[model samples]
Target: MITLFRSFFQSKLGIGITLAFLGLIALAFASSDVANTGTFGGVAGGETVAEVGGTSIDTAELRSTVETAYNNERSQNPDLTMTQFIEEGGLERVLDVLIQGAALVEYGEKHGIVISKRLIDSEIASDSNFAGLDGNFSEAAYASALRQIGLSDSMYRARLRQSLVANQLLAPAFIGSAFSENMAVRYAGALRETRKGKVVSLPSALFAPDKDPTKKQLDEFYASNRDRFTIPERRVIRYVEFDASSLKDIPAPTAAEIRARYERDADQYRASESRSLTQLIAPTEQGAKAILAKVRNGQSLAAAAEGTGLSPSDLETERADYAEASNAAVAKAAFEAARGKTVGPLRSPLGWHIVTVDAINSTPARSLADVRDEIVATLAEEKKREAVNQFAEDVEDGFASGSTLAEVASELGAEVKRTGPALSDGRIYNTPDSVPEILNPVLSTVAVMEEDSDPILAEVVPGEKFLIFDVAEFTSAAPPPIADVKEQVTAAWRLERGSVAAKAAADKIMKAVRGGKDLDAALRSLEKKLPPIEMVDIPRSALTANSERVPPPIALMFVMAKDTIKKLAAPLNVGWFVVQLDDIVPADTKRDDPEVATFRTNLGRGAGQEYAEQIDNAIEAEIGVTRNENAIRAVIEQLSGSGR
Candidate 1:
């Protein structure tokens, strides 16, 4: 049966049909039932963790998958630790993916969806992972890749066969799904509907008291919300940087070496002449000669080409090398023509041409004495880079041997830079403008470290420099005394009281509007002074209009029924808003829109995905699945070093 299935697909669809299975198996595990718990009753540790039908997912398989994922992530983030990976739920994600793949494979077997060995071979042969330097399948390369990931050839082939079967089972679910035009129109109408409404904002500034808060009131506010005034943990770092720019006392180059370099690059130093030509091509030699006669008689190229019905762009007018001219004949005439001379009724591939030499530019080569300083500076910079690289290597070796940055700096005759206490947000207590560029990269690397971590060496700018740094002092987060920030506390207290007053006023206005009062009249009755009420049409999507003035209110207007009023807090802490839903304009059903077609295609895809998930869930439930906690815990401990 498997052989018959492969023969049918090969004769009907060829390589294209096999290529479609490339990502289908991965998609089966894209969403998983691993998040749903099953009764933990099965084999012991280091054995099978779960079973779908007759297929078993053992501890060894789960461990291999987790280790592969961890190594891949570690390649990009060298600092990632096993403890951190386990804490972030990486193990659970891999377990879910493995279980999901096993479930699909079981379903395919029951449904009699056979995938032949030949199909699996074809897929593996086409995979670039198994290809050699010459771009052909190599058995040795395939064996090496599997060995690196700790997979035997038979195990790898079995996994590939399972994926092919899973693809065969799930492909039919979405391949033929379609959505109707009416369904698309209805969905688009809801998204395209617009509402006209009026909004009134009660500004908090209007409700502020005339006088500042008393000390007693400020103290009470600060004591109750002390956490708001707390500063986060900060650090003071000290480091020494070794870079090319710090290299000094470089030796000067000799005159003999400078002259030798100039002679070696003699061709590059030689100059060539270029001419700007305005040319018009004609169909025949007689027509070209006639145009050349007119241009020689004081007619401009533009006026002469008017009869040819060609624009100025078609008549080439740019500078080019003599070798780059239109043809051999045109090249000879263009170089020989004197400045402002008209020449050429020359014939070639692009017909006959009438040419004019507009201008000639000439450049002379510079003598060795003229460029001596430039050559010397270039050589000095090259030497400086080499010296800096050697010095950085020495610094790294010293740091590895438990030497302090100060000791390294003393030996190398370099100065050490120290930073004042600064928050993680790059805010310093003092000397804001003097923040060194080296501090940022060092701080980012150490941000994940514990307080007072050991000094380490890091490359700040790749191929440029390295920094040796350690946390000099660390300060945990703590609230400042009220006396230290009394003015700031007083301002915050006033805003809190004003927000209360503004909310009450906005609610009153909304109450009036809901009770049949006009929107404009409700704003006039408010106790606090408010902004002018403006009525504008706002679309649900708001793709075209600038709705920044009252974005939250506009968003609420669409969800509310017509003739309803709601009050909301203003965005960005401005104040409060009273909004009324005046009217709604549904999308026009009679007109055909291009966006509606796009909407239909997207909806069809979503419906197909939901259907596929339902099918997988049904199959999984029917087959029954059981997971063993002991085996799972054992695999997690082995891979992540975490027992839980």
Candidate 2:
């Protein structure tokens, strides 16, 4: 699947360039802009990675950007390593983005594009990382976040200015651009082309070593493919939780306060009568009488109103309130009506009211003593909530004042607990181990947090429950000792050996078929009985029509030259395939074909991206990008800890 997408991205469309632009912009916005001046092991801080015109990108800057990108990727892919990240073009992509950004900035300056300080300030203020509890920008939070990342305010602003400049320069090129009709038609025609092929599979198991590998051989295999056996970084989380019940000594509501609360809402305790009415107001008295007559004749008030293109609504209101809203006469009629009875076509400012008394509720007035107990309970709850909030704030302040998790836990009389090592995605590192459900919310929080840094207080159930936690033990990602995974390593070794033999066999089969022997005859010529050759007929459009993964053998046949046979290795050391392309059929498509219009529309959407790429390329060419290969390599090595 990865190969299929890679092939498409690398094709004539060059979709990867557009994707690179988008991904880089997202990374630029998300990445911490702190320029770390710290040395990376043996690599000097000032070493140049690349120079765009007269601007130099130092090793420190590159390391920080690559590290941020690696960390971002690692959060989603917990097992990802710096080495794997670099291998998968992480280094090149980040370096290319850096170079492009520098080029854009330099070119923008020459062309009078200016990114204002106000814009950069707005960007910084809008970042959620610097937001406070009130959900607004906080200067203290911004400063604290910068301090944690070792990025000074000035450095962050400068880096932000560059990104803003680049966006200003490229955004215009991304609009109002499109591919030509001829180019669109040609692309559409290519999609309609078809190919016929034959594929023979040579299974690795057929050539695998029957005997077990020696201990030395197993060790060597484990050493070479250590990444396969390595585990993702995991941490033991330590935390203490507390809620409202934990805050003791909350003052009970006093008699005076309860009395005051009762007096404040004295009107609620007064005698009153309210009617629940479903009514419809008509345009005239005759219409109201017609509706009332229908209600009397077995139809519901709502049903009767429906005939007049109107609907009856239900509302419960006190007599005085209803009178004020309508008129005294209408209210008197509704209030006088018995429960489940329909009342008159009474006149009001809102035409005439045909009302149904759905229900009539009566209340008797009460003295202050009657609701005093209820008021006390309400006031007590309010006091407890306020105390709980203050307690939480005090705990946070304690941590902010250099207090440890254990110290805060001791003060609160809460037990500090340690969880089994867990991954960023909240899975137990040891499959058999488990932690209490209460700790789940904090696993992701502590995953990216530095070990032994300040503990954080997180709410588990909003205002009701909370947790204060920190990383107690941190383990870096690396392969375990060979002895622990000997059996698994031995199996892998056998598969690797088998795959090599299978590839050799596939080569022979390819040669036989290319030299005029039939595919089945060639397969029969091999010593081992292989899987039978399967013939495939596929349309080029079919490869991408449903967005499904095309089998590697079929995918390989599509890209192969007609009348040629080639050996292609299957993924995961599964087997080897001998693919023979029998014929290629050019698409017989007209200029007015529906597919042509479809492709034109699709390609037109990406025209702006092509324009942006061209603009970027032109800018780089004009500005002259000079890379220091040795320095770049050193920076990657330092980030991967290989230099150490």
Which candidate's TM-score is highest? 2
Q: Ten residues in a row with the worst lDDT in model 1?
A: 26-35
lDDT per residue as tens, model 1, 89-193: 766666655666677778777777666675677667767766644455655456544532335576667778766665565544544244677787888888788
User: Could you tell me the lDDT of residue 372 within candidate 2?
Assistant: 76
Q: Where is the poorest 10-residue window by lDDT in model 2?
A: 1-10
Return the clash pairs for model 1, or none. none
Top lDDT hit = 2
Model 2 lDDT tens row, 1-644: 01112232342224533323222332232333435566758898788989999899888778766766666666567666778888888778777877886787799899887766755666677677666554556565565555434567886676677766765666554332445668877897788889998888888888899999987888778878998888778788888988867777888999889888778768767888888999877657887898889899999986675424345679888786677667788888888889998887888745678888998889999887887766676666567656655765787688788778888888878999987788766778879766788876555456556576677766576446878888888887778898888888888888899999999888888788778898788788777877667988899889887878988888888888889998888888978888889999988778777666556655654665677778888989999999999998887777677410
Evaluate model 2: give its TM-score. Answer: 0.64
Whole-model lDDT per candidate: 0.62, 0.73
Candidate 2: what lDDT?
0.73
Give the TM-score of each candidate.
Answer: 0.49, 0.64
